[model samples]
Target: MAHRIAVAGATGQVGREIIKTLAEREFPAADVSALASGRAVGGSISFGERNLSVGAVERHDWASTDLVFLAPGTTGPVTLARKAVAAGCVVIDVTGMSDPDAPVVVPEVNPGALAANPRIVASPVAGAILLSLVLHPLQALGGLVRIVATSLQPVSGAGKDAMDELFSQTRGVFVNDTATPEQFTKPIAFNLIPHVGGFGEGGLTDEEEAIAEDTSRLLGGVAVAATCVRVPVFIGQSLSVHASFDRPIDEAEAREAIRGAPGLTLLDRRDDGGYVTPLETVGEDPVFVSRLRVDPTGPNGIALWCAGDNLRKGGALNAVQIAEELARRGALRG
Candidate 1:
């Protein structure tokens, strides 16, 4: 049975990727509707040869759609999500709208969490998604007692505007001109920002807090300390994870566990150029892990670095996987 699909925020990076992924995966859909702001309406986007004219979400009819992929952006699906769910449509949110009441999910780490939720599911942010994928496998070995993570997130995680900011800033610098900060608080070209979100009470940015919260949520309550930073790169997100377990885990044991974990690609070597980087992870699906070693600081510690495509597994791809999970469980009755 073919289901009618809707991709909201269609003109944005994640939204465009969702539509591309749908076609690449050869998804069985009765039809796909691209919805966005008024500015993007009537502009056609190509999905595997089919030209789809963008529909202004405000004026478009949601009655014909059965499932909605809410892409990442400020225009969160809050108002629209309510309207869609009220109409009996399943919604997979790509944006980081915590929605305290809604279930936060990373299919590989917590598909079960999403199964019980009705109408809408919130996907974790790029840092959380990439971090959780690596941590979940370690859980089966013993149990994660403590997790300390540092993320090197690219501008792509901020959407198309941030990417443009980085590009324009870099070009301006080369020509002896400086691009003003428009989308970001600081100039992103040739610079790394330690802050990804606004500072809160404990000096923790919302992005940092979100990483800790989302990781714990997916790991079933394991404590996590996260530090998120924005790098100057255009794509890919990387993380340096320090995991402490109940029992001791040697380098061999840690490597074996991660190597066998599904949706994760292990590539650890010692000599120069042994680990993974954001540049190598672009357009890739699996979370690439490298720099595996035992942290001497903790009683039972394992430290490693991992990277993955933020636009794919981090955002659009995860949402698509959730949609697939919903179908497998008959959650999308429509």
Candidate 2:
């Protein structure tokens, strides 16, 4: 029997992509309900060949749903996910909110952890998800002691409105039209914003904080430092990661480890432009890594560049994958 799926934040970027990926994967969802906030009610989203109308999630009966995917939104996904779990549905959340009581999972990294959890799975952020895939093989080889990462994130990482704001601002400046910044603190067109989220006391943005915390939790280590920056790109995110390992790792061994990892593809032939750019990685599923080199300063240090579709493997696709896992484990009630 096919499961009944309900998607919260259905009108958002990741939510819409979740619906598309689910359909594209031919997931067995006998009843797929598109749910959003009250403001987005009555709207419609295209799910494959069928357009699903958005309904207010507050009015829906989640108890009858077999699975729920909560997209990133202002509404607390953790709270909603817990409610869905209490209602006996498997909850897969794209938001970075991790409950100490629940499991924060990246399927490729820690799919085993899900079996012990109740019913909710917290998806890591785009940067963390991509980083985990990049680091998985390295971690398996010798284990990572510390990592310094800098993310070049796109405006779409902020949300759909941020993408629109960048487009509108770019056109306004080019056409001499009045430009009003709504989604971002400053103009995003032809410029870079060092800040991606709210700043803390020490000047780290929330996005950066999330990367550090989420990476630690997902990797089962608390030794990663991250600096996140918003770039002019509309989609995809790139990361420059410098990792210190617990033991010596040769270049060939590192390459083989990364190449052999699941959900990751190594393009690290550094002879003649062997790398994956954000544009090349957009809409792609796996985390693409390139420019692998040994850090000369440390005996066990390596630096690499990685990229992936922030909306797909970073958010929506990961959520769908978790749902598939739950279904396979018989966690989803039909």
Candidate 3:
């Protein structure tokens, strides 16, 4: 049941990770095409033990491709996605440019949503994925009421250039050189920016809005308030989450729930350095949960710290997992 697959935006950070994840997981792909813009067409990207010569995505023939992973930075991704769908190829959109009504899926949380064999499925933002993974298990203990989260996102979430800016700025600071902000609005080295995306109505950034919207959708009908911040770190994302449920659930009960949940690891030890950090979660799949405590402010509230590799579980790995879900459901076309 090998299927033909194409990964658009094959050169970007998340795009490359998608290809790598497909290979690492040994997806049943009869053909895998690496595609990017014209500038990256001739470049070579590794796929398993082979190197794939990149192709221009705009000129690719999608009629024969059974599936496409639409990563960010693909020029006219919205148009490209429609074209792919028209060609009868299922599209897994990671670009956030899909139809507003498209099903946003995190396989670990709401995989049943894929039973319909949808033409287009959106991979939720990394922050939302992280938030949802941790909160979903607890929802089974009691219905979720409200969620308050502040995310410390790494620069890699922005793109490769943002990572470069962080590195160069840190180097410049030690060499007595001024580090001007390029990928960011402010110097990211030794500093933090409370801004992650464009400010929208009521002063909430687009990132915050997306996280709240996606989390609520994923968790059924819970209220979510998010404040996304750009930190000086490199790879993983961290969150301080406070969640209230309909029933009073103790920290021990919540810990047991997280431990048994798939795609989640409970690492609470109540001692310094006993829990996972952003740096330690790099290149990992499961979301790491730590600092679990019962929030005293509310009757049925719990507080915790969570970290994960945004590129993997948050983006590429999640998209690849959706493709896997499709395969398992016999939804993918040959």
RMSD of 3: 0.7
lDDT of 2 by residue, 34-72 (tens): 998857999999888999998888778988898888887
Q: Which candidate ranks first by lDDT, i.e. highest? A: 3
Q: Could you tell me every candidate's TM-score relative to the true structure?
A: 0.96, 0.95, 0.99
* Candidate 1 residue lDDT tens string, 1-334: 6778999898888899899888888777889998888578889888888989998888757888899888975255788888888888988877766256678888878888865756888888888898889978888887889999999989987878899899999999989996688878888899888989889999999999988998888888889888888999999999999999999888887788888887899988888998889999888989999998989997999898999999999988888888888887887755
User: How many clashing pairs in candidate 3?
Assistant: 0
lDDT per residue as tens, model 3, 69-186: 9998877888998999999999999988867788999988999999899999999999999999999999999999999999999999899999999999999998999988989999
In model 1, what is the error at residue 155, expressed in angstroms?
0.6
lDDT of each: 0.86, 0.85, 0.94
> What number of clashing residue pairs does each candidate have, in the order they appear?
0, 0, 0
Better of 1 and 2 by TM-score: 1
Among all candidates shown, the one with the greatest TM-score: 3
Ranked candidates, highest TM-score first? 3, 1, 2
Which parts of model 1 are misplaced by more than 4 Å? 74-76
TM-score result, candidate 2: 0.95
lDDT of 3 at 312: 95
